[model samples]
Target: MDGKKAKQEIVTGGQFTIPGTEVRKMRSRKGDRVYQIFVSSPLEEPPSSGFPVIYLLDGNSVFGTMAEALRVQSRRPEKTGVVPAVIVGIGYPTDQPFSAVRHCDFTLPLPESELPVHPKGAAWPEHGGAEEFLSFIEEELKPEVERDYRIDTGRQTIFGHSLGGLFVLQVLLTRPELFQTYIAGSPSIHWNKRFIQEEAERFAVRLRDAELDVSVLLAAGEIEKSHKSRIPEHAKVLFSVLSELESKGVRAEYREFEGEGHISVLPVLISRALRFALNPGGPHTSFSSV
Candidate 1:
């Protein structure tokens, strides 16, 4: 073949997608916003009890990485301890890796006077729709997914990163029973004057009075501490509180990814998060560069 033709063929590309994945759009009854849902099902028949399900945030960015990882790792479950699962990515109807709408969907309500001022003095995007967003998921999305797939509701997991991570903590504190496991990566705990910490305290009180079975994995990049990001310390403190709840049927663990940064830590976190969700008996604390 001619050099030009060969190079052209080498660079040719088409739309890429995970084999068992499908996309659908649904407008939330709680709001005017429409969400793009990505679902990836394992090709193998599910266990008699049904496949575990993971609800992932920022779907446009990480859905493929996670869905494919589950496909490959679950193949050798005896070695990897990773089981096949149905992944549901909740994202906006946009091509962008993350949508501006997340500022609303991922944050909790705060008085206008208490809102943080933008670093550049720009007006912040609309926010404080987390309650509505959570309702949409519990009331609308979960039911839709259950109708279409055989999922073990008792094994559901929800994962989020950054602002999305903040949302995960909110759900865990206020609605711990909604999902069996919660994974928060480099959570933005510094937001809103560290309001989530207070929520954690409240959750502690509730835990004393209620019997709930749940697990949480809090992870952050080691570089975040060197960069003066509050995530590492915040996560550590949250870890301490959660760890004390082991006797209460709460399984909590923490991980710090070596030689990684805020954005770069995602891929490694995804792998570890999957293992943590599927294998609840893994180590409680660890460090890794992979």
Candidate 2:
């Protein structure tokens, strides 16, 4: 090929964006670390009240699909009963999942001994900074988002999967009020040898007396790998704990999608999470009203 033709055909992978959507990327400083923050919100103006926002983890992998799903389902809420939302995807400035930094970002503070060990003992990256990431969202990203768009602070939701899913449970246990709704899809509760179970026990104790209101939805694939992964058993334990919360007046639900594994369940997971979190609790809440 001629030099000119070759140059013209060269494709540059720049910032990805879709029409009628805005991308917000920034690096905010905290001590010695400058964390990159990314957000994507619909171009459509929010309702008179404000836009509900869903903060997604692993944005590099799920942001485009989630945002597009939000756009389509919300376009005709009268039919789909899906409400519009500000889709805020929180991810680093990398295309790769499980990057070195996220190893530090999305995990709980635990020693190496707590790490889940396989029969062959697969090595995992360094962990134990999920609290810092939570602060980044609460103290930094939340404020940044509010400054740019009209948002319903009371309707904030956070969704996470896998290790990110572990972070979601941490958020619910440690700071339930940060978001009114929390969704953990195939969360890695087996991490740190079930550290989250201890946290959930504490949370249940607190909920016995606390008047706080929060909604939690935990979804797992019914056919999730059993031989090599703890996802199915871990999810069952979490689901049972969430049922305890549900009985205690906190709105909670769990479902196992048939014939789906960890990754294949997302399409149903994200859309169902929207309905769970965004239910306005009106007479027209269900599809029957459509």
Which candidate has the highest lDDT of all? 1
TM-scores of all predicted structures: 0.91, 0.86
Candidate 1: which stretches are off by over 4 Å? 1-13, 280-290
Report the C-alpha lDDT of model 2 over 1-290, residue by residue, as the tens digit. Answer: 55665545667878656655655566655534454444556667788878988999887778777888777777777677677778888766676753566666778777776666755667776677777778788888889889988899988899998777878888888888788888999888777535677887888898887767788888888878564666877777777877767666567777788988888888888878877876667312576433
How high a TM-score does candidate 2 get?
A: 0.86
Error of 2 at 139 (Å): 0.8
lDDT of 1 by residue, 1-290 (tens): 55665544354567887899999999999987899999999998888888999999999999989998888887766667677899999998888899989999999878878776666789878899999999999999999999999999989999999898989999998889899999999998877545877888888888887778898999999899975457899889999999998888888989999999999999999999888887534434333322
RMSD of each: 3.4, 5.1
> Which pairs clash in model 2?
108-128
Candidate 1, residue 5: CA error in Å? Answer: 14
Q: Candidate 2 at residue 238, lDDT?
A: 73
CA-lDDT, candidates in order: 0.88, 0.76
